[model samples]
Target chain A: MRRWLALILVFTFALVAPGTNPRAGEGQAAPEFTLRDIDNKPVSLKDMTGKVTLISFWATWCAPCQVEMPHLQKLYDTYKDKGFMLLMISADDARSVSRVKPLIKSKGYSFPVLLDTDTKVVSQYNPNKTLPYSELIGPDLKVLWQHQGYTAGDEVETERRVKAALDALAAATPPAVAPTATP
Target chain B: MPPTPRAALVTAAQALLLGLGVFSSGLAAAGEGEERPEVSVSGQDDLEFRYWRDDRTLPDFPEEDHLFDYWELVNRVNVKLDRGPLQLGVQLDAVGMLGAYYYLNDVRVDEFDLHADGVTFPLPLAYANLDKAWLGYQGDSAQLLVGDGYIAFGRGLALSLVKNTNIDIDSSLRGAHAKVTLGAWDLTAVSGVTNAQQVWQDNPNKQQIRPDHWHMVSGLRIDRYGLGPLNLGAHSVVYSFADRADLDAQPWEGYGRGVDAAITGASVEAFGVAGLDLFAEGDLFLYPGGEVLGVEDNQPGYAVYGSAAAYPGRVALLVEGKHYKDVERVNAVVSRDLYEVAVGPTLEYERVITEDSGAAVNSNDISGVRLRADVAAKPGVLTPSLTLGLFRDRELGGLHFNRAPETIVHPIAGVDWIADSVHVLANAGFRVDKRDDLPGGVSLGADRMAHVDLSLGFPIGSAHGEIGGDLRYFMWGDNLNQQTDFTLLTANAAVHLGHGVSIVGYTDWTDDPLIDSVGNINENLYAAGELQLQPADGMTFKLFYGAYRAGIRCAGGQCRMLPGFDGARLSATINF
Candidate 1:
């Protein structure tokens, strides 16, 4: 009887526990918070309304991050015109600001880079205890998906998610009404 | 409060059963999947049952008598579900260990029972990796997984657990993971916490323990866009430790001041030429108190590594080189993980002459070069493997390839022959340097020593029961004004006698020389045997009786505090 109770307790945790990252198809609003970018400018989550958002938390010295940056830039470039915004929050030290800015320039990346010098945004939003994690937020302010780690196969999936989010937003926006409607 | 023995026994039993159940589940899964051509499991259990007579070595210390017992079971199940699509599956293992105190060696330094010292029953303790599970899916086109897992990037100078899991700490994370690949581009991401074993144990004890040690990681890799010979990968992390107080209180040891964002770095690797591939990576860590630390300290650590493998028909030759700033073990807060640089070069040769009979030969040659300043020198542990290799520095005694201080010269040569179910192996090396690190000053030419070993192994009968034995010897030349000759002979045999029972035994004899810092020899002696039996497939009972002049065990080049036992030991591993 005691063993049965213990097993039941474990099953309950699996079902109700808030996992390391958000699960797909979970109908819940994404946590919102504000953080300052590298330029010491406020990047508010609420302000990025009516557009799909990709928030990536990263550090400068990570090996996998070095491999992932170019593709992220590509994703930003391809869908920037379609109301898609990619916010990269770097957890690097403030001293690294000088180093990171140069790295960005050398790579010729144009995406908006934010600095979480204090790591406040990570704690409030996802509280990710692991690294190389990404989140896709729908324009409706719900967490569409969340995942961790980087591998050779993740690039294709990220692209598909980006395009799908854009399509969903486009469909949600009503077409322009005819001018004769006023008459 | 009184120490009740019954409660401790019950917890131990629970842990044992849970571990067995998990092991059986994995075995059952492996038998079901045909797609998995190779399925295997490795399991180990360590249990110490003893009655304490005293906690000290001599008569001066107080004496206490009590029955103390604990056990740990670790089982890993791996399956290559499909090679064509490259699907890989692994289970982190079910951890079953009980009681407030397991063993002197097994106890976590910080763990403690909150009850009164004399009381034992209903011992308040913490557990890890229980009722935890994870799954991973991998393929050429795409991959997906939802379960607890682990991730590491680069050489682990920044984040590297995808390989080495030597450290007895949080190596696996509890979370959901996924990755997808398209042509030359690949992306991956994971979300999890430090240890899945702890799971929700911190909930009810939230005030005392915060369960919010959570994180999310994502990155991508692109290679040879067909535009140019280029490769790139990047990683990012969003993490938060629910309880930062513990980290905040620790002293800044060059690594960092804060817990969150302690390990954060970036790298850019490239490939060129047919045989040459190169890489360079760096890291940055942000912490509280307005302090920033690099990989080891505030200094950015970088390295360049390359390898060349040339295959002339079926015979192949390969050489790999790694040169990086060394991460100082002590005073990391003040120094970069790597300061002075060292280089390692290894050449390996392998070939197969007869494919049908499975006859093959393999060999490797190794060399290392070090550049260091006087300030980086520190006393470190000694490892026997370094003596076996030919190339080693005499001026530095930190030990091992990664921890050596000052200049080092070391090389290794080895050969292996395999035919059907039979195999033979032998390796020899010589190492020397200018430092007075060894017990003796340069007595032999240029402070160098020699190590050699040989072994032969084969299987018998239709069941492929394995039996093997070998001999190894290490001779230290009186190079650094010191002299000692050490020889170790080990013989091992394993036979499946009948039914579910198997008998295995091994004996080791060693001739060691005791010497002082000046290389003055003090004593020379011999030490020798181990016998174990598995009555059934589930439990392995072992009787280890050995007379050792000295026994030493080390991890990460760090030596553990082990008492020299000249008598006997009884041990067992039981799995359901």
Candidate 2:
């Protein structure tokens, strides 16, 4: 077993030796997963391509997450029309997953809410399993910003990131022609 | 909430790369990030130091009788690197077990074996190992992984194969997993042997860790969506077991050992039909071994579950039903530990599960129905909900304390309200599980449980600081014949100072003799305090003291009886 571990370590180093820049890599593309939304409709990461999307990992039993959700709701309502998407993925598991949709409906949150009954998705992005974890991804599937926990007003920074991504999205595109006056 | 940009700028494939680069630079400096960094590294470190001790209050013994003093430190670090589509990750664990020595672990070992508590020490008191490593690739719609992975099939009735962190059980398949999404169809398959985590995060450490058993588990799942309002899926799982649990053998060396059992299932989901969302699944458990898991029925088991949900205006309602006949026997012979491959969601409220209620959670021949409704009394400001669950346990043996058939009726009411800076969340429930159904339909015995839990939040002085606390009370009426009734209560107060600093004081009182926990305050009480400091985002440090009680905890259809903890600990979690 020790020898086998040594072989594993040798391969590990060999894998890491080819890296060009370590610090340059902060954000990786989000793993693609398909899950049923609150309404039993399938929602996939591929559905959110070409958009600046903010993914929030939350649970019904998490008090801080409950307090932070209203702020996310405001962000969703603010940016829903701006080609900005918000995926409120619940990590409630099977125990409290039933409360996810009710909680979201009570807040009138129109953002897409996905149920991660097995906690697979949250384990991927936030290995620490921190509640109310948020990650901002640009149109290119690269994560632009990530934040953990919430302090009521932390959405200010999240909103700023969303604005920058949207502005940059608009800046990099060719301006559309204005419609001519009708006769 | 202020107004945001009217146009979200929805879709623009042409600017995908340029927009990502410009946005990356606009927020962060140049060279820090780009549309897709060639090599992105992200990792997490969780380290804990514990000073384990205990004292006894027996009349025959003196003060601090059977005193056990041990100091242990366990650290786990996992790092993931993604270069373009290629991803590699590994988790390393280091443990140091010091102090008190132990005799025979099995007690039958007349031979004296000096051990540090449960582990025998030889070379050193500290050891480190490469816990987990995996290599994978993530493309546009396809994902290929090898080394270690997690998979859950349809509602998990047939095959779940996922992590259960609550009980400190993270069993992964030490093999390969592949998935591809083509248009509206998604296909996923996995093949490997079960690899349970060696160093437990919550439980004590053990030496000479190896794979639970060389159980060759393989499965394939396929789903097709967008068939109008109907979506369909099906899955099949095959399991092969080893004849022996040998620790010295290599993984999968015993595999070509004959197939033991298989599970095949199908599921259907429908949405946006007459203001309702419906889902149903049916699975057949094939026990090819004739007599499997000590059951000589030689008959196949089956499980059927269905749920319907509706959101009408400000109200949300859901109704679920399940009938499982000998469905828990699959994979029962694969592992001598807590590694279960097939688990389906249960109707019982897992958070409020007790010793008596846990029986129904793992009952093989059980059928039940649950109805829940939530009303937004005043939208987000105030909401109230209620849930009622009913179950019939026909054949109870494993994990069942009751000897006769039983009926369970559980009703819970909850409310969530926020009044200007003050928020209150509370829930209270009483469950009755009556057994020995007489010929006239009357129960001769019953096990009852009642619980109440709540959390209150208060805004502090004008500085935006916050103060809150949580309280939980449980009373159990056990009818295990020789069991004793018990009550458990825990209360805590939290002070959240702005800028990611918080302090919490926890108090627990329990008289459950079944729980072998040493209290910090008195024989029947425990106390603890934790100070959490988040210097910056994505990093947290926690310093804790005192002890806490233990009990049976169930999550995601899986239940385990966790041991009580008594120690002083400090931990840190950093993700970057």
Candidate 3:
């Protein structure tokens, strides 16, 4: 038991100290990837720079993902104006990618939805390729936390984390000074 | 005398160092006039340990026979170093096992060994090795990578070297990959041999793992983007399989004309054109070796896939179709059992994939179409969706349980409602596959299936509770090769108290004869419990104890029969 504790400690310290790539959880720097959003624009982890970003990997054929989508949209609405961004990437390959845009448009989701037709992006984060996987990254692009598979009340916890990240970002940012009136 | 494991490792280390020295020097010389910024190093480690038992092992043997207590530990670490436009990455894996067993020749056994029959040798199953290493560079207009990496060309119809976790597939190319962006055209090229992962994180290993056969592969893609809503692209992949008995003694030994196959494809994507998004792709599969698995004519195969979507105001509609003839044969000669080389979209619902429905996902001769429509019934409060899919399969070989041709039709409807803290989501579908007459004007009954999946989350005082269930009923056709009709159901409920705490209960019941496990509570029912804790922002843990049955699971156009487990599991995922 002591050995197990020591092993866990070492792994945590090593990754927390100077790690850069994402294991999709705390102390990890989200991995790098490139994808095309629904509007045919390039999107990547770099877009989250200087902002709190939530990245979700889902598919059109996954039922749990659909259940989570409505909640994600609600979360985005709650935090979008407060230094927040949500990127919902589809792992639908070429078969069901076309439905991604229509579904978003119909639901009126404002977050950017990227297309990972080859599933390369999801592999970098969760090699097991669990559906509805998500990661919350801070302004520095370091992952704050991650969640796998979705439950109905899972978003309640997610909302708390998102708010904390946003508050942290807002506290760190210095308010803009008004222009001095000329004498 | 054969060298010891330590000696072998030392020699391998020396060889790797030599290769690294030469490789870095070559790249350094090419970048003589370039700037080298401060190099930053970062990486991540994922470790999973599973200790469980099958409970099927009898009490007649020592240590509870073969399928008793087993544990396996697997860890994969990826380290990346970056400086300006240059990057280098190395990934390694460490695997250890004890008392692990898998079915071999209908008998539960550990990794194969010719020296021992009765005694278990768990030491031979432990291994640690270097998985892959790669170096990459990115400029303002060009990108190049020279070691092991993933690549996909044109929706993966020609070459897709990415991971498919649904089937436990993780592979890369062991050569060079390059991409260049011109003013109006983007060109990408890759040439390498197959580099398959030796250990998997999600699947049970049954055999002694070894290196890949090193099938040579090369691909090229050219795309012209920003062409005023009309983008065009073309790509090609060439493969030369290595089918021999040398156990990779001499890789790249077969590149003759008779051992190669080429798949070339073209695609066009139009966005925002007349308020519609359209995409169409066509591919030609050319095999000069005449080694295609189930094709008798020795002629080339072709595939056509297209989709169109229109999102107007509050309503969205999408239609997609695919005609694939012998497209699945591309996987036959290239690491057939390890990974798939070309994977197109399968328009079937993935969660409800059964043996009968999964067969049509990769049929050599199949044509299908699917149409989906979503309407915003109440702005931000409610949305409903309807989908209809139809397909016909002409081929009666490989994995199909029917003897005659069949036509399949599926229709599904779903709705999403969100009101304050109470949310509801539900979906229901009906599917039927009608087989043609069996040569004597006699009817070969149809297979009919219906399923429902629903989830509800509501507030409970200051806390909240959620309930979800999936129901499926399958009626078998009058086919001699299939099993009897069956029904399957799963229900789960979770109660979330405050302060990062939750408890979940799970139950599964099935009468599917094809399934291989007896339930934990009875002959056809299973029950389990789980507790989740997130005491801090960076740490999360889950503890589960119970039993679950096994069945065939399909995803991303691939199918595999996953095994059942009955035991306790504790797992932790930490961000740091």
Candidate 4:
């Protein structure tokens, strides 16, 4: 019995040791990926570098995700002109991809919806692959915040984080130079 | 003053209205750019009335007949408040029954007796209680929560506290929980008291109500991520039972102090590895000296589970295996109800060996393997799949497999099709169980089982609605080589009549050969029609009349038998 216990301890230590910083942790650079939107148009994360980006990984079968979508849309509409963007990435696989378009259309949402058919992009952002996962990336491509799961009224905190990031970005940008007469 | 169900319902409604008023007023008072606490309210109420014809006597109470007419109303309310980093939530449930149901009335004699200290209500019915109330704080890197809540770890293999209303089970722990993330490590800890069971006893002289004893539970888990694509985790849980000699005198006593137990496990999972994902976990259970059927001894057990899946191109394949030995020890300390207690991991496969069959895992002497493959025949249009499973179980105390081992093999094939407005799904499966080296004269259980299910749904373009139908058949070959079969057919249709009004109708028919006795066929039919109105956003009301039949309802590997009836149902829901 003692031997078994020792063996298990060794195994756990071996797995836990030797791990470097995670790629998706706060202050780490967000990975870049290109995926197709609901209309089959390519969307790349690198293109949105000058603005604060909020990427949410969700699925149609997740109840909490469904509840959070409307709030996300509201946030997007409220801050779209203030250098903020929200992208809802659907992790529906090939088997259930057919249900995504109809659901989005039925809900009358104007936010851009992307399909992660193979779940390749979501895995880069969320190693655990938890549903309704949200990550906020600053204008500098560094992850500002990350959250797993959702509950009613969680939108408040999420909105606060997004606004704070946007405010910081605005404060960092230099003012525009005065226009000069034509030479 | 004491309040009845009717008065309670009125009070609840008034309180909700008052809350809404306050929320609105608060929102109005907040000036532009001012921070205000966010409040949200959501709830649903279901009222159903049933009438019985050709009433039969209940098996338990042979002297009395089943209720000829009855009505029940179930209401659930949830309120959430959030401001900055602090959060508060409350959820309440109330159930009221009125009818000729004597048994149900007797059960309500002491409904208000067992409540958490410092919590009180005007109406304390058998079905009314404060389901959940919690206060929590969310930080950038940590979270602290207290009061009633749900918790789970690593696919719930070792510990899971959840609530399933469909099965009338709520295992939410009343406790304190904390989660923190430090660099590459994530830590979680929980300490709580399990919810007590509500048992009702009916006697001629006096009605008796006893609450199931509660136990202490604590657990800790640590997880490390960023090992490329691999993440590892370790978890341990301890259940402590209080010494209660009084419980020994009861006819149905729960786990006592003598049967304290602990579970420890470790898991490793890897994802995004060349389109392959893998996970494996091993759990060890330790039980101090305990008496099993009057025999006392300490028996330790262990279990191992692993699964691998790969989605390469259009084809998806998965393989899983599990082996358990003498690991089925009672662990009610972490569960709200005794029936919902489970200490073993559940392995889910297709039909024959379903996940809902936790009994298969509780045997403590079983091993199983399952393999499945799915191919996208036409991309998103059609998909077909095939599955195979094998399970083996050895005798109670035998180390060798030759001692009356039971083996089962199951194979299944299925297909799913989806188009612009049409969807269809079907599956067929067969199971064969073989036994070897039977004891002197013991009989075999089920030898063979087969089943088929088909469902089709489509939109009625002209009517602006949808219609669907389902057909299912199942056959069981019992020990005596006798065959029993069940057939079910159902059809439903709905239509929108504009102005936020809709009409829906459904009918179900069942034919079972084993409902009563051998060779006695029982056929039942149920029909229902409903009208739904959604006059505005966040509000809906539905009224329906139906004739229903009793049947088994299952969800999330849990099953419950619900009594059927013929009656009307009214429901309303609002979210804001």
What is the C-alpha DockQ of each candidate?
0.01, 0.22, 0.34, 0.03
Q: What lDDT would each prediction earn against the true structure? A: 0.39, 0.71, 0.74, 0.57
Candidate 4 C-alpha lDDT tens digits along A1-183: 353344334333322231122222456555555565765455777678899999998875554575567678889999999999898998764323434554564345678889775454553454224578788888866667766655444577789999999889889988779899798
Task: Give one digit per residue, the lDDT tens place, for model 4 in B1-576.
Answer: 334436545755665555445435635645888876444222222222223233444456554454434444444454455443454555655443344334553673231233332223343322445545666655556767676555666645566555444345555566788878797787989887665423211000011123334555678999897688778999997665533433322211323344476778998877657766677888887766334311137677777877777766667677777787766554422222334433333343322332113345445677988777777676545678787888886634322212356687778887766554455666777776666545676545545556665555454553345455555565543333244566656677777554557788877777654433111123466788899775543345678777555555543434444455456666654332
In candidate 2, how many Å is residue B113 off?
8.0
Between candidates 1 and 4, the DockQ winner: 4
How many residue pairs collide in each prediction?
86, 5, 5, 0
| Selected candidate, larger DockQ, 2 vs 3 | 3
Fnat of each candidate: 0.00, 0.20, 0.36, 0.00
Off by over 4 Å in 3: A1-33, A44-52, A61-84, A125-128, A131-183, B1-44, B55-67, B100-122, B208-210, B244-246, B249-259, B292-294, B334-338, B535-538
Better of 1 and 2 by lDDT: 2
lDDT tens digits by residue: candidate 3, B237-329: 888776644333333443432445788999999998998899999999987765544445667888888888998778888888989988788
Expressed as tens digits, the lDDT of each residue in B139-247 for candidate 1 is 3345554444544443333333221121122234455566555665556665554442222211111112222222322323222222254455555443333333332
Tens-digit lDDT string for candidate 2 (B412-460): 9988876545677788888888777657765456777778878777767
Better of 1 and 3 by TM-score: 3
Model 3 TM: 0.85
- Model 2 has fnat of 0.20
Task: Give chain B TM-scores in order.
Answer: 0.52, 0.85, 0.88, 0.75
Best by lDDT: 3
What are the chain A TM-scores of the candidates, in order? 0.81, 0.82, 0.83, 0.86
lDDT of 1 by residue, A37-130 (tens): 5333446666678999888876654434544666788899899999899998775532122234434533446789886543434432333223
Order of quality (TM-score):
3, 2, 4, 1
